[model samples]
Target: MPVFGLHIRILGVALAAFVVVAEVAYADPTPDFFVLLERAKAAPRISAGEAEVAAAEARALQAEVGPNPSLSLEVENFGGKGLYQGTDASETTLSIGQLLELGGKREARIAAASLEAQAVRAQQTRNTSDFAAELAVAYARAEASAELAKLTAEAVGLAEGDAKTTRALVDSGREAELRFVQASAELARVRAELVQARAAEASAFARLTAFAGSKTPFDSIAVSLLSREPRATAVAGGTAPAVAVAQAESRAASAKVTIEERRWIPDITITGGVRSFASTDETAVVAGLSIPLPLFDQNRGGSAAARSEALAASLRLERAQSEADADRRAALAGLAAASQFLSAQLEVERASAEAYRLAQVGYEAGRVPLLELASVRRSLIETRRQTINIRLARVAAEAEAARVTGRLPFGE
Candidate 1:
């Protein structure tokens, strides 16, 4: 018996220590939203966009370089029957040739490539802005889910207390048995809602951690993003990233048109070399110039195609500007409407909370019926849920506004 007691005491100590360690491990502080945003900036998709910009810059540099010189060697009159059969009768020539571009073709190419790089850079900017907005929306959703879980858990606790109180009253012959049954049913319903809310919270956190590219998933955010008020600043359409991208593409297309128009100008290839005649035992310097006549292909079709593309680009730019204006206006309007709705919902939540408290007091005093108290409790829960949804809607509208304005969502 003494040895058995010793073993039991040892096991109890080990279990207590394990429980303490588990609690400490699960007590990690919530993650900061700004830190998560920084991590998201380094995500693979954003890095891919940066790589595209680098590649475009490299292409621009390549366009600035002139064509490489060509070297050639020719041996003549050496493979023939009589004089070409002997090395003494052979003629050898070594030459270096260069193509001299005309009609500012090289300059045109450089301009076009540089503008193309600018367009790529603009597109990258737009992509970064869009991703930031998406991350903000994800963060908001996670925070909202967390809030919903907390609210549901509180409702479950209240429902459990109500059921216990009704059971006690029924046992004492104050409340009827049916009242206790109703309270138990309501408690079960709130418990089920709590389960659903927790599942949604887990899913939202998973999405948030994925967006942040975190190896260890976060369970909660440090700050409540849904609680923050959205900024109501007016954004200009001209300053939007989409409009900037379109403008850059339009300029690049115009540069392409210039390149195609200059394509009809012939380039001159100049060759200079030394010729050796073995029979005469002599060497001479020779130079030649070759020009391609634009007889069959004058690049007229290419020029026409480039012009058409440029026109299309111009139209796209105009469309982008119009869409940006409309989108910004719509986002601002949505934000305003959501703000108004959230304000009203907050008032409703307060009123419902007060009414539930009074109903609980009255039911305990035997002045209020179980059904009336349940109705008030349900109203409070629904009002709180609606408030959460409204807050999320407001955050989404703000994120959209920030995206259209080329600003980071929920960022300074």
Candidate 2:
């Protein structure tokens, strides 16, 4: 009987230690930065990389202008029949000419390409900004989930302890069997919820790992980096998003119009050749000039098309500006609302602290049973979860605000 009593004491001590360890763990949840770092690694997709490459290509496009001059050599007279056949006689001639843009064609083409390159660069910036914003939001969500999971796990642990104590009381004729059953059911529910939370955390971490692609598990994130990258997102969200591209396309369209207008003039092609006959040993040189008469195709259609595109580009630029303004307003609203909610949530948490203390006192005095104590404890854990959510919401809202305002939270 003494040995059995000793075994019972050891078991009780182990259970008590387990509870203490769980509470300690819940008090401060470790961050999962490894998940977020993974997200950052794969943030920019292949499509965005292609956009950057296209911008680079546009810069290179400026080098591609009118075609280079063509050259050729011939000995025609010697290969000709009868009169033209002069195997021993020859005449050599050389001529060179280049096609130049008569109007502002070349200059316009270069300007348009340069503008297009700028627009592509802006697109790249926009993409990167979006990547950072997404990362911040996801990081907030994961933190919230982890904290909530820890809270829920603690609730389940408390509920399990209550179940064992209530079962013992019921066997001793102190508590009813029904009360023991109720406690068990509550413990099961909390356990189920904790399982679900763990699953959610895993999913969140998977996504974070995919994007950040880092080896470090999160102890904490630079709340500043995750807080908001205002300036960067704002630049992307600003008129710069599509402006460069629009300007480039517009310039290109204008260049096309200019090229078409130049067609109203004409092109002058000069050709020259020399001939020889071997039998008569005769040699002669001939030269001629050719020009096209624009009696019908005056490039009227091409010029009209070019003008229409430029007009379309102007409209698109205006639309992009309007969208950016709307986005900024929405982001600001989110940030303000989140801040307000976080403050209110903290007040609610203070109210719960007193309730928790009273409930614990009542339970020890035996005025309130284990079940009641478990209920109040669960409520406290849930309230803490609410606080975590509120903070996460604030973090997310701040990130969005940063995205819109184009300012980092470094100073503010």
Candidate 3:
């Protein structure tokens, strides 16, 4: 080979290797949402944060009441008195004392802390529910988009085959030229629709990735399909979100009331010492009770605040119950409706398949017009797509109901 030709061949080989490596290095562009959900469940980051807050509150509640003991030593208040000659003046005094909380204040404080911990932990569980619901929405959307694309692909194939057949018949002087042109035009229009459908699919996939908080898109995922919409044959109750927050608030409010009641009580302190004034040495003992008198400030405002909060908690619980009932009814209705729709689509699917198969056989046998065959092909594909969509919607509805009511209509 000529020297220049050898260089060109070597460069082509290098380019091919580079292309292969690039393809191999390429990662999925979409995020795997199911994996992310698993991560969220395992880490339960919200729960962890709640746990930390609860721990802090518990520590505060358990903290022993009173000023931590204080210790002091003095020789006339310091080394500045070092010049003193008398023993009494030279002697240093040392004392240690601790303040004490009164009126069972420590126990009340601890109780309040415990309530707060419970509230936070409940909030964490609610967080999990919210995440799960959101994941369901994204999954549903992706399935919808994929179904749309599948339908469009089927339409394009049908249209293209018809156009080619018509063109061949026209060339043989067996079909009108206008028919061929019409078929080709329909094929072009359907192909454009297919492009849009794929774009929609991409958009849905991208959104799923964004919601999942993942670095790489999922390589592939298998989604559960539903033959019918979700229906709760069983009585439905509220999901974890409503239940958790209500319980948390109620516990917290009760805790606050107790803490407020303890507020009126005061703390105390004790100390002992020796004193010398010029002529005689004397030992002195002091005991004191620090009583917080509520004459001017009886904590009425705080106690009232706690009472209001407790009342609010009651209302919240009631509201959650009402919402849950409504959700259950809506979900059950949707499932029943979806089931009927799926049944209807089943007939459409079977009819379309039979029509397409018969048309294909006739077209090849030169026993049918190309336009008829093309129409059947497109109808079959579109029908299948529609059926897929119906099934996907049913699954989505079921998932949504399950998520809302905390139980599947039929069962998880």
Worst 10 residues of 1 by lDDT: 20-29
Task: Kindly provide the TM-score of model 2 when superposed on the true structure, using C-alpha atoms.
Answer: 0.75
TM-score of each: 0.91, 0.75, 0.75
Report, for every candidate in turn, its global Cα lDDT versus the true structure.
Answer: 0.85, 0.61, 0.66
In terms of lDDT, which candidate is strongest?
A: 1
lDDT of 3 by residue, 290-409 (tens): 455667987888999998999899889888878877776886788678778889999988988998888878876789877687777777777877777777767666766766655423
Candidate 1: tens digits of C-alpha lDDT, residues 1-412: 2434544554555454454334334333346656777777788989999999999999999999999999999998886787568687988999999999999999999999999999999999999889888888888888988899899999988888899989999999998898887787777666666666766777677777778776666777787788887777644333889999999999999999999999999999999999999999999998999999999999999999999999999999999999998998998898889999998988888999999999999999999998998899888988998999899999899889889999876654
Task: State which candidate, 1 or 3, has the greater lDDT.
Answer: 1
Ranking of all predicted structures according to TM-score, beginning with the best and ending with the worst: 1, 3, 2
RMSD of candidate 1 to true structure, Å:
7.6
Query: In model 1, what is the error at residue 364, expressed in angstroms?
Result: 1.0
The positional error of residue 303 in candidate 1, measured at the CA in angstroms, is 0.8
TM-score of 1: 0.91
